[model samples]
Target chain A: MSDGYTESTIEVAGLPIQVLRGGEGPSVLVIHHETGNPGWLEFHNALSGSRDTILPTLPGWDGTERGDWMRSVRDIAAVCSLLLDELGVADVTLVGLGFGGYVAAEMATANQSRLSELVLVNAVGLQPEDGEIRDQFLEAHADYVKSCFADPANFTDLYGEEVSTEQLIAWDANREMTARTAWKPFLYSQTLPHLLRNVTVKTKVIRGTQDTVVPAAVAHQYVSLLGDAQLIELVGGHNLESDAPEALAEAIVA
Target chain B: MHLMYFTEQPMSAYDEHAAEEGVTALLFSNSNFDPVAGSQLYNDRLTEYKLAEEVGVDGIMLNEHHNAPFCMQAKCNIWASVLAGATERVKIVLLGNPLPLADNPIRLAEELAMIDMISGGRLVSGFVRGGGTEQLATGVNPAYNRERFEEAHDLIVEAWTRPGPFRWEGRHYQHRVVNPWALPMQQPHPRIWIPGVLSRETVIWAAKHRYPYIALNTTIEATKRIWQTYDDAANEVGYDPGPENRGYLLRVHVADTTEKAMQNASQFMWMQGEFTGLAHPVWSNPAGYASPRNREALVEVMNGRRPPPRAQSFDNQIENMQIIAGTPDECIRKLRTILEETRPGILALWGNDGRVTHEDSMRCIELLGTEVMPALRDIGAELDLDGPFDSEPPVSISYDEAAKARVASAAAASGD
Candidate 1:
């Protein structure tokens, strides 16, 4: 409940989903990445200053009950849409971060009736024509997290010099959920670019200038494919939300 | 005791430097594979198996791994089929097939059945969850590994035992027609064995199902714990388990001299860390592949809170009996200590791998057959240890005297 947010578990289509809500204005739903929610970050705090920032811990991530029947990203996207409908929120500005961006994009394509704007930060749904999406599962956890940051110190600061066993388990669980959904095509949907053409929301595709995870070409692809989307390159790495929180917050609210 | 021989069938002809550079056996490029050398190694290994049979080893144990040079057998069943044709009297024990990797369990069942028929019912079918890297290579979701493994196992068993054309509606598998024409020659299906290392769940599962649980190269302390778990599970399932339900695999290599044996045995360490790098921790134990408790233990090792078992040096391994190598007499003496401690009904002697020469492997197998195995049989008799053959496997449907008579008469009638 700290950081101007109150946390509660809400049932969405029979599954209990944990959500954090704060601030007051136009609704802004913040979706987390594959490592799961780090909880109430600086960007979250900043975003809550004006807009009503709603952060839901996706099922199988920390604090949320696993949706065992949910097998794909589209299923999760459907769950989120249902969550929004259950929350009774409209014209929601959906801000998806990393893997969350993929889910958000799917949500937009499936049902845009509840959305007003879309912010995809370092998303990984579209396959890059050039360069490859860095495989997080293939690399060691620390190295993978370091690769996500422009400065490794940011990761250290966020996770600390020593990660606890509990944290590692959480990360593993999140990765397991990610693997269950996105392992086959490996973080990118082959038809996501084509699908993005149907996402008619005002979209902002943000990529960190030094992102090693999702290539610049992927960002360009998202922008080119979307009916109303622009690419914003921030001076950070793949984890722009953590490394360049202030700048990322500015872009989200812009 | 039922004594068997095994090797990883390493493709050691590849560049050691390239393998070391890759830092993982799974990711090591196959561009370095030498087909000509691979052919030679394969022939040498097959010859070794034949020699093992001629030398009177009861069985030849084989295992499979994918995308790794450490184990050349991509599918152990394929080798089992070849051995079924190539040799007689030796049980082709697959320890075992990666059940979850098979998209169609019926195909696997049929293949195993063919091997059984070819070998005159000498197939000891085993199932394994497989290494986590296998899941990545085959694109099977790690999260569903256990479910897939259990479902596929059930499906395969049903395919073998039941009059098929039935439907399988399991969570991870769906077979509308569960029919396989090639049923195993063994009545009520071939004997199923389970092999694992430090997986309590697997041990318990094996025990509950009354399958022999083979501990693969685990430390004596770990092996004891595994047996304890198995015994407890067996007790819960209303059975008093005996040594017939237990098996052990040891990296035991014997040669003419102790010095030569030691030298060849050090080759067993070839895949440990020096050359074919150990699987990367993340790749080897992928998310959701292991139980939560096991995953925590692995994380502890990865984070340096606990040292990995691989940290043991070759000399330490030898001292600890994890690796046993000597002249046949010397090996026999050391093996007595292991046999007394574990009292397993089945023992698999992992004879050679890595840079161990074909000549040395042949000599090792010859010596094991001529000296070590006979002595082990004597020790087993003295200790009153009986294998699955001597004492009925708890789970298998018994081939009664009448069934045996029927089979004998059928063989007699088919004879020229």
Candidate 2:
């Protein structure tokens, strides 16, 4: 709560989007995961120390109205690009956590003129060569949340001992939006790997060593596909932003 | 009243323990499915339907589910088509085709029309949004489920009623050549019956369209509330709804004696966690599949604040009259209470499911068709209940008219 970030609603493409801005320097736009934006987190606080952290709640998340017109992840990507244009932020470092990473990669592929660097943390968007991207929809919400963290204790710490009805509803809304974009082809794009060939921006593909959601092969594939990308394995779970915030922040700022 | 026979046609030959170990229905691996057992079960179900027709039930109801061991009918229309050819006198009521799953509604319209023609216009076409898990299995987005369902329903209705060569364009579905050569034999298309458990939106939708809303084994209290909602919606659209606009599906198994009937009725609980718990919670109530209000109610169920209808103990269900199993006379007496309270013009008797043997099912169907159905008809006549066949349902209003009526009603309620 003491992240020094100010939250406001910004109009982009005629849709009201919730944006949280803090710190003072080159801008770093943080796209949230499928769980929606978990408010301004520890990583945002740490990143705000050096970079101007700009976190916008994706459409259909807790803070923003659902954009029924946005049918696919590409549509979301295009919107984020438009957001950057509206913000008029130059040399933006886009940090995407989990599903947000997929959006970041998509944004880069579409237009990278505004983006200086791209960081994808346990992001799911590519078909794995082996194993599979764990289906969050198939499992219980609590079980899926537990699996997202290395130690279930972190989920307890972040979400308290019991998840509130409001939090559950928000998560359901976020999952609905995720299902809208990522239901078919199942959180991965067949042509994304090929599309990454055109993403020439400097990219860091980070994965938690203990992530059970997105397979390790998928993270490696992201690194392999991106022209100027390197893989960074962190000691955490799928939600590195929450599990190892300081480390994830350092990896992005490195 | 129109009496119809129904069953989930459960394939109960699989290892029950394995099903319990995994998710029971959806996502329950098909590796446990034995084709030989499935083949026999399918034929047995067909045989039961034929017997149901022979025994004198007015109609035979069929439904389908995907990737579910609980139901073997992957496509109910296939069975509807088969029955259209095989049966002579029964209305092949589909409770119904999962409209949202069909990428091609025109093709579906053609199939339904063909079945209607083959059956001498005995097809009572119905539509459903399908279960949330079905959306996952079919790779359909649950967010677009309602949209797809409405669009598909409109397209199919248009295909049946309108002349071909019409250009169709909608949000979720589109066709340049909106023409199906095979139109329904029934004038203005076959009667549409909407079946659901507890979705208020579906009830309202059915009411707005003047389709009979069939409550699928809901509690008596819930069914009353459903009728109230339907009646209120009907009033908004400037029509007085009746029993003809309402139907109720109840799990009623009848036999010569109470003991055998009770034992056979218990088979409805043969599936692990019963019918309600057959699906994994997440799969069953996927995000966006339910409205926000309904989703909150489901959360209450998950939190154990409210028990799901099927989660009640078998005896409790019987006590509640949600399930009725007894001798012919006993069933008729109990059903009279249900009929008196719910007052559905169309009654679907869910005869058998789970491990209830085919022989017992046949006998159950026979008992229902003979003693129970005759008594029910008498009771229905005494109660002045008439099905769509007897009395015409109120005409459906256009969406725009319904919307305007809703606003007017809201304003009137607010004393505007």
Candidate 3:
């Protein structure tokens, strides 16, 4: 159990999923972005001190087989529902980043009973009136990776050694999963605004100032939908948890 | 071998400089399209197909692409219908209609059935999953591309064959009353073809059903591998597919002078690369579009590994058979080598790409008609290459026998 966590393989929706769990307080579910594994990050543990943080490496990640049943973001949200059922967690505060944020928003539309407080960090699922979401998959993998960091040089600091094959494979898998669920709408759900009206849970929208992948206006658009929600602009860019883990963690619990 | 003339009908009236902005899914602004030039191109290209029929090619192949200057013909079946009414004694091979993008496969089935009847069983129906940008443009999920493709194919085939008022409930599609009064003139249906590069699943699927698989502008080694994949898959299903089940589509421009043909070949490359530009990696490969199992091989097929030096260069394209450019005799010699190796019965000639002038294309086609045709035909005969015309396709509409059986059963029931 490294960094106050225990890892196990759990069956969710008929697929074996690798899940990471930690913390002693209320349960929290965190859905990660297209790339980067929550288990491999130090900031992921910050929440563990005060809450039970559940992180499951989504399907088509790290050689995980994608269920044919999983064809849309709503489908992935369904898996999250099944995952929560399997975990037997209730009144969960869900935290999501990037693509996961899209899934969380989708989950809120249907599974409002299970979720309480929702934290969306650099969430994608809305199209702003202006500006646009850059296609990260179009950029070079290295360039995309650098964009994920507040300082590009932190790439070397994050992994001092040359990037391993397993890392590359994991990144590819995450990208593939993202495409499966997000490609059609190109990451925005048209009905989400109407659906957001149905979700009564408290919500917080997190953003990094320098993050241009998903522009700040999109975050604002997401905030404008929820009944009880506030937009919190942070100093760091999209990689909020990585660049400002301590502050981001405090803000989530606040 | 049945020779077919094919073109993407690229609209080259656009400014080449605008391409620098970006080509996501090869998506670009339509500001460059001149209605006058585009209208002329449509007429001229159709005229070229007529000339192909006049020159007496066995078939004419057509296809559709969305949101790109690569192919102006986004509705291949419409083009097929036009060709059916406009031409005679030539197979209209629609290589084909992209299935997954269609919201209503029944309508497509009806339209195709009408086209086949109009053409008097001259239609060769082809289905494609479509290009990556297609998903982006149509908002069809790319992850469901293959599944939608398979389900749509099944639904269309069922719509054609099964006595209707039937129901189809699929993951991507649902239909209540799938009955179309319009049916093909062909006994069961017109021939079906699938064009692919290196997707193993596609190869196996085509071979398993014995649908003729056409290899697009791919490398020689890659073509062999894709064909071999098809052959091996066919063998597993207890059938040794003949040349009739395989086809090769290549860019072949033959003029009086080799210099003219080579210069025209540049136009082809310009269309492939510099024009709309390569589809962004994300759009091309949306998440569930491919699995880890076949993704690597598929990418390699798109960008050939172990390609000969200057593989992307124009000269290498000619040497590699990706582009066949030369005098008639030269084209014949090179084409013969390919025929010997691949043994494809359906040879598709892409006579024009990009901005090759209509005059140059006409001259090239005339030369192909006069000089290249006879020699290639002799070689095809020598090699014993037989197309779908010579042998019954591995899979075709079996409506004739079914109709006869229905009549016989009714007569028996009536004691007539």
What TM-score, over all chains together, does every model reach?
0.94, 0.94, 0.88
**Model 1 over residues A1-254: C-alpha lDDT tens digits?**
77699999899878889899999999999999988899888888889899999999998887467878888898889999999988899999999999999999999998887899999999988888999888877765666777889998889889888877787777777888988888888888887777778888899999999998988898888888999998898999988988899999899898
Q: Which run of 10 residues does model 2 chain B get worst, by summed lDDT?
A: B393-402
Which digits, one per residue and each the tens of the lDDT, describe model 1 over residues B143-166?
889988899988888888778689
Question: What local distance difference test score does each model get?
Answer: 0.86, 0.86, 0.78
The predicted structure with the larger DockQ, 2 or 3, is 2
List the candidate 1 regions with Cα displacement exceeding 4 Å. B21-24, B273-277, B303-306, B394-416
Ranking, TM-score, top scorer first: 2, 1, 3
DockQ comparisons of all candidates to the true complex = 0.58, 0.61, 0.38
lDDT of 2 by residue, B308-412 (tens): 545578899889988899999999999999999999999999989888888999999999998999999999999988998988653345433555677688889
Name the top TM-score candidate.
2
Candidate 3 docking quality: incorrect, acceptable, medium or high: acceptable
lDDT at residue B53 of model 2 (Cα atoms): 87
